[model samples]
Target: MKLQAVLFDLDGVIMDTAEFHYIAWKRLAEELGIAIDREFNENLKGISRMESLDTILRHGGKADDYSAEEKRDMAERKNSHYVSLLDRLKPADVYPGIRELLLALREAGIPAVVASASKNAPQILRALELSELFRFVVPPDSVPRGKPAPDLFLRGAEEVGAAPEFCIGIEDAQSGITAIKAAGMTAVGIGSEAMLKAVGADVVLPDTRRLSLEFLRGLLSA
Candidate 1:
């Protein structure tokens, strides 16, 4: 089948907001009396905000210590910190070649969708001034489950009226790759070839800077 739509992940794949996420996560960890590093942050990628907090809390052996309300409060605090950091974002914050790729997909008559786990996806899109570029932007609240479960990407395809086999998903995290595969779409990984391959991505690119319709089509045909 011909490719009908492309689904993108928001943070590490579309923008360099990983730093902001890490900063907020680290701040929350410190306040919660836990330790976190960049390596630990890698585990948080492509997951929900509450899930990220839970992961760090579990790492600190404190996951079961907090009540549900307390956990929600912590997540909210982290989000407030993250929202404050978005002030520094601009169109320039978009990854190199991302806008061009979106434009190319547009010129080629392909619909693009963003399937990020971030609940603040809409705000992030507006901050980057790329809100109008997508056919559908899947909000985190729209689905009960996030990446690694296939719900988000599947919903993206559904919202765009594309069949799973006719959709392509682009992501920079292991969980995202797993989700794409589970959704039965073409998985395009934006990171190291070895890591992406290990996670079962159909095609892996070093970065979006190398993305082209020809390369993608060839991969699909292969």
Candidate 2:
């Protein structure tokens, strides 16, 4: 039950960049004459940029309208917009207690790693002033597949020099929980308990602000 590392998803788990992502995507969708709302944006969580574009097109019933190259261009445009919004980020943007948890993990010899589907993960971490906290970051391009596929989480565990079974994956999306389980790691979902339980998360908490070394150790031993 020894937990050697904690793999975190950057967006909702580390900082609140979900809205920025949504805004970027929504703006891109508008350019394509497709409307996007927050509910639809939720589906983009834990998915790659291109995959998100695909989802957006599908939701708008226009998946076949754009060629692959056009979709690539659209994804790039969305990313540019997203990056522009990143200038608004500050150290205070980090969720309460997240810094404490990272410090605690480091003090206890446990590495913390970022395993995010965002290609801009490193930049976002820097913007949030959290780039130095992680042992390593596994961004979208680091893995061939995104969430629910296990590759990203597995890479995170490897980067931290831990076996999947000895790692704890903290994520706020169901796809991320699926990926964690598929990687044979312990899943700690940071959202609704019932929803996370339905996806087989080992533990569920309202947020990372609620996590503590004692609580994590208990979960690991349980």
Candidate 3:
């Protein structure tokens, strides 16, 4: 199979915005008198904002405490905090091998697209100054569902005019790996190998630093 396009998950795959997200969420949880730890934050990865909020509320046993409008307000508040943190980001914040891999893909005439669940994806790309490297950043609202569902990845391949079988999807979350597999694309996972493998990732790398154009091509060839 030929590699037609590469679909990327933004937060952990391209950079480390996951920590910013954790900080924001932790702040929100504290405001609600709920406690959350890093291990719990892992469950929030690769999910929508509303979904993450819901998960947090459930965890705190306060799911029924907020009205729908109150929940929206809380989510907005968290996003505001997250966006504020993003101002600290710069082009150099991109992970070790990501920039080089993206450039290599460009040189090889391969297209890349962001398939993140984050509504702030475009802003994040702009912060990293890597907006031009990707053909499109799939809008979160455009898809009916987020990670752990195939909608986003499927739409990403469609946007790039690539069939799912001919695409490679890279993600740092198990939910995202599941989405890639569900979309019928090869999954290149970043982060814990066992966790990603359990979710059916085709190949698991420890971090973005290990990603390379040659490694990607090898996946397709194999």
Please give, for residues 1-222, the per-residue lDDT of candidate 2 as tens digits.
Answer: 888888999888988889999999999999999998998888998888988999999999999998899999999999999999999999999988888888898899889998888888888888888887789888678677888899998988887789988888889999999999999988899988998889999989897778877777777798
Candidate that would win on TM-score? 3
Candidate 2 residue spans exceeding 4 A from truth: none
Worst 10 residues of 2 by lDDT: 211-220
Q: Which of the two candidates, 1 or 3, achieves a greater lDDT against the reference?
A: 3
- lDDT string for model 3 (1-222, tens) is 788999999988999998899999999999999999999999999999999999999999998999999999999999999999999999999999999999999998889999998999889889899999998889999988888999999998898899999899999999999999999999999989899999999999888887888889889999
Ranking by TM-score: 3, 2, 1
Candidate 1, residues 1-222, lDDT tens digits: the string is: 688899999987889799999999999999989999999999898889888988999999997999999999999999999999989999998898888888888889888999998888888889888887887898888887888999999998998788999888999999999999999999999988898899999878888888876667777678
Pick by lDDT: which candidate is best?
3
TM of each candidate vs. truth:
0.97, 0.97, 0.98
- For model 1 the local lDDT of residue 115 reads 94
Ranking by lDDT: 3, 1, 2
Q: Candidate 1: global Cα-lDDT?
A: 0.89
